[model samples]
Target chain A: MYCRQPLRTIETIDDLHYNLQLAVELEFSTLPTYLQALYSIKEGSNTIAYSVIRSVIMEEMFHLTNAANVLIATGGSPALNSPEFIPIYPTFLPDNEKWFEARLLKLSPQALMLFLAIEMPGDLVPISMITIGKFYENIEKGLKYLDEKMGADLFPCGTLDKQIEHKYYYGGGGIINKVTNLDSALFALNAIIAQGEGAPNKHWDPDKSFPLEDTTGIESGDHQLFMQPRELSHFYRFNELKKGRRYVLGDSHNSGPTGPEININYDDVYNLKPDPQSGDYIHYPELEEMNFNVNVIFSRLLDQLHLAFNGQPKTLETAVCTMFSLKEVIQILMRNPIPDNELGEYAAPTWEYLSPEERTLSSIR
Target chain B: MYRLDDFYDLSATLTDYPVTRLIGTGVGNEYNQTLSQWVRQDVLDELYHCFSQLERNNDGQVCPQALRHQLLSNEKYGPIARNIIKMWYLSIWYKMTDNWSMTYGIPAYSSPVIGVESPTPEDYIISNNAYIQGLVWPLMGSHPMGAKQPGYGTWSDAPLNSIASIHLQ
Candidate 1:
C-alpha cells in the first residue's frame, strides 16, 4: 500500500538549499554505521564481508561528498560541525519510506540485515512510502525546475569552484565530478542514485554475471566474483553477504545468492555495545576518559570536514588523515571489556560531538 | 591481588597520565602480566594492598601525599612504581638495579630480564604494538620509529587531544 511520498515540493531557492542540506545530513549519517561496523570487525576475519563493507564505505564517502558538492553548488553549506549531524542509533535511515531501526552493531546476521534494509532497492522499499531513489528523484526534479525558472542565477559564478574535485578522495568508485552547472548538478544527483539504489528497473548487481548466462539486461564490468570497480549497489552487496553466497549470473533477488560460499564467523568481531552514549561512561571513569578522547577526535573530524566543505577545500586532506587516526582510539574501546557490562559486550565508542567547553579532559572530569 | 583495575589506576597515579589515556593504550593487561612475571608475588600484593589502604584512608581517592609517603616511599614498592611509569611512557621495562634485584627479583633463571622477546634483556621493549602505542610518541607529537606512519604531512593535528591538552585547565 506504500505509494510514493508526494513529490517533495521545492518551490524557492531556500527549499532547494534545505533539501540539499537534508541530503548532506542524510548521506553524512551513514558514515558511523559503516565505521562502527568496519572497526568492530577484527582484522583478517570475514574477508568477503570486509571487502564488500570496505568498498561500500569508500562509495558512501563519495556519496556524502557528492551530496555536499550538490548542496554547495547552489549557494548552500554542509552542516557537519553541528552535533545534530550525527544520528542516534535504532533511528530510521533518514527519509525511509518504511521505518526500520539502524543500529551500530558488530558484523553479524543482525547487522547485515540492517545494512540490507538501509540499502533496500527502490522497488523493494516496503509499506506506504517513496523509495530513497524517489526522494533523490524529487531533488532531481527540484533542481531542473529551479534551473528553468532561474537560469544562470541558480548557480552563481564562483560557487562551482567550491565543488570538491575528484582528486581529493582516493579509491576507485567515488568520482567527485564537480557540480557547477545545471547539467553537472543533475549528473551528480544521478550518480548518487545510480551508485546508491541502482538505475530504475536495472538488475541490482549485474557485473557478477557473464554475458553467456540467462541473466537479463544488466551486463557490465569484468564479470568476476569480486568486482574491482564496485558494481554491486549497496543493497545487492549486503544481500550477497546475507545469503552467504555470491550473485552468479542467473540468480534473481528472490532466488537469493547461490554461487560461492562466503565464510563469516559471527564470533570473530569485537562486540562493541550498540548505541553507546558518552554519559553512560561517567561512573566508569576509565571508559569515560576513553570516550572523551573518542568524542574529541570525532569532533575534530567534523570540524575539519566543515572547514573542508565550507571554503578550505585543501583541509579535506587533513580531515581524511584525522579520520584514520580515529582507529587507534576506537580500537582501544572496541577491544576493551567493560566492567560488569550488559549482554557480555565489549566497549563501544559514543562518537559524540564535543562542545567547545567540553573539548578538554579537564572540563569532562 | 593482581587486579587489572588496581594496576591501571596505580599506573595512572604514578605516571601522571589520566586513567583513560593509560587504558587507551590498550596494553594494560599485558603490562599487568609483565608485573606479575617480574615482581615478587608478595611484594606486588603489598603494593596493591598499600594502594587500597591509601584510597580507603583518603575517602576512596588516592591522596597524592599518601601515594608519595606510603607505597612509593617503601623500598619494595618505590622502584616498582617508578618502573611502571617508565613502562607507560616508554614501553620499556628498565632493569631493576643490581642492589635492588639481589634483594627482590623474582626467582627465575633468566638473570637480566624476564621477558623472552628481547635480544639484550637488561631492558626490553614489550611488544612492537606496545612500542608503537607508547605515550612518548604522542607526548613528543610524533609517532614511534619504524611505524613512520600515517601522520606525515601537516602532522601534529592528531594529538590535539593528547595528555598535554587534557591537563591544560
Candidate 2:
C-alpha cells in the first residue's frame, strides 16, 4: 500500500517503533525465500551456503530483539508472535502488480533480480510508478491510517524524558503518527544498506561505475557469461557452471539474463565435471541465482551484526570476532562447493561457545 | 578558567551523593568546597556569555526551539554550544537541588519524566543532572529536532522542578 504521507519526517518514539516494525517485517519476508534457496542447493555440496544462510537468519532474530528493546525503552510494546508477523511472499501490495510478484523458490537470474528488486526498491519517488517501489511508503500509509482511526499520537514521549515506562494499556504514552522524511528516511535505509552493500550514491554525484571485470578472481570476458551492462557492479554476481559458453578472458558485454543478449554458456560451466555415479554433472536450474542470493544474505547478515555493535566497543569487538568467524566459514564454503555430511563445522559459532566476556555484553540479547 | 580535574572532582562528588540530598543542598553548600569554587561567578559569567549567544530571543528561559536553533545554526560552534547548553541546564538543576536541601530540611526529590505527577524519593535517588543532559545533548548543525521535542520537555521538567522547588519548599 502506498503511504499517504512521507516516512522520513518521523519525529517521535512511535514513529521509530513503527519503522522498526516494518524493518522486522521485511527481514521476516526474506526468510522464506532464503530458506527455500538453502533447500534448493545440492544436498551435500551446499553445506557452507546453508550455514551462511542459517547464521544470517539467526542473527535477524537478534535484530528483532534490538528493535523490540528500543521500542520498549520508548514505552511501546513490541509486537512479536503476532498473526501479521509472518509475511506471505509475493503478496500483492496496494500500490501496483510490479511492486509485488509471485514468490519463486527456484534459483535463477530472474529470481536473483526479483530478490534484489524486493530487497532494494527504487528511489522514493513522489509519483508512483508501475513498480510502486518504496516499501516504507506502504508502512507510512498503514501508520497514518492507524493514527487517524485511533485519534491519538504514538510515541508522545519526547527525547528528554527520563524513563519510558511500559504501560499495559494503550493510552499512557502518545503514539507516533508520522514517518521519517525522505532525506532522513533515506539516511536510515542507507545506513542499513551501506552496512550491507557499499555506500550509496551521494546527491548530485555521478554514478561511478565499477566494471564487473574488477571483482576479485572473475575476469572481464567472464562477465559476458552472466548478464551485463556489466556496469552495475555494486550487486552480487552469481556466476555458475554453464555447459556451452566458452570462458572468455577479458570481455564485458553481457547485461541481464532475459535481455536481448544472453552470454552464459550453461552447458560449459556445469557439464565440465560430471558425476560418475549419476553419469551427469551436478546441476540445478538456477544455481547461479541461488549462489548469489546466498552470498548477498550472508554479506548482509555480517553487516547487520556489525551495525548491532556499532557504538558499544565491547559488543563491537565481540561482533567483529563473530563476523570474522562467519567470514572464515564462508571462505570454506566457497572453496568446497559441497562438504561431507556434517554441517555444524560450517555453521556460525553457537551462543554456548561464545566467551564469557563476549557473552556478558552481547547486543544480541 | 575551570580545570578539567576540578570538573571531574565535582562530577565524582555529585555522582556519590544521594540525589535528594544533592538537590536540597543547593549548588554551593552540598558538594566539596574545592569543586564549588570553580563553579562560582567566573564560570557562570563565561556560561552566560555562551548562553546569550545561543538564546534566539532575549528570553531568559532556554526553550527547546531556542536551544535546537542555536546549536544547529553554525558548523563551528554547533556541537560545543549544544554541549554547553546541556551542561548549563544541568548545572542549574544541580544548584537548585542543593538550594532546595538548604531551604527545606527535607530532601526535594526530582520527578520522573513520565507517569509521575509529583516528585518522589525514588526520582531523587536515581536522577543525575549531567548524565541526563549528556543523553539529550544535540549534535551539530540545523537538523530537525523531529521526534525528540516531547521527550526533551518531559525529561527537562524533572530537573527544572528539582531546582525551582527548592525556594518554595
Listed per prediction, chain B TM-scores read 0.77, 0.22
lDDT of 1 by residue, A1-365 (tens): 11123446888888888777777776766777877888887755787778778777777777788889888888888878877777777666565544677677878788888887677667665435666677787888889899999998888777666678777766435467888788888777777776676544444554334222432212232333223233656777787788887766666556676677778888889878878877777778888777788889999999999988998887888887777678777877777777788678778887778787789789877
Off by over 4 Å in 2: A1-12, A45-73, A92-98, A102-104, A121-189, A195-207, A211-214, A217-365, B1-169
Give all candidate RMSDs, comma-separated. 5.7, 26.8
Candidate 1: residue pairs that collide: A2-A127, A2-A128
User: Positional deviation of A70 in candidate 1, in angstroms?
Assistant: 1.5
Model 1 RMSD, rounded to 1 decimal: 5.7
Tens-place lDDT per residue, model 2, A1-365, is 21323335444555656665556555544554544444344324534334434433443333333333334333454443333543344544322334456352433344455545443424322345422224444434444554555443443344212221122112111121122233323333333332122224333222333333432232221222124333222222222111112223243323222212224322221111110111111242122222333334344444443343232213333333334334323222222222232421111111012222332323222
Q: Which ten residues in a row have the lowest lDDT in candidate 2 chain A?
A: A270-279
Worst 10 residues of 1 chain A by lDDT: A210-219
Docking class of 2: incorrect
DockQ of each: 0.30, 0.01
- For model 1, the local distance difference test gives 0.73
Error of 1 at A365 (Å): 7.0
Q: Quantify all predictions' global Cα lDDT against the true fold.
A: 0.73, 0.33
- TM-score of the A chain in candidate 1: the value is 0.89
Best by DockQ: 1
For candidate 1, the docking band is: acceptable
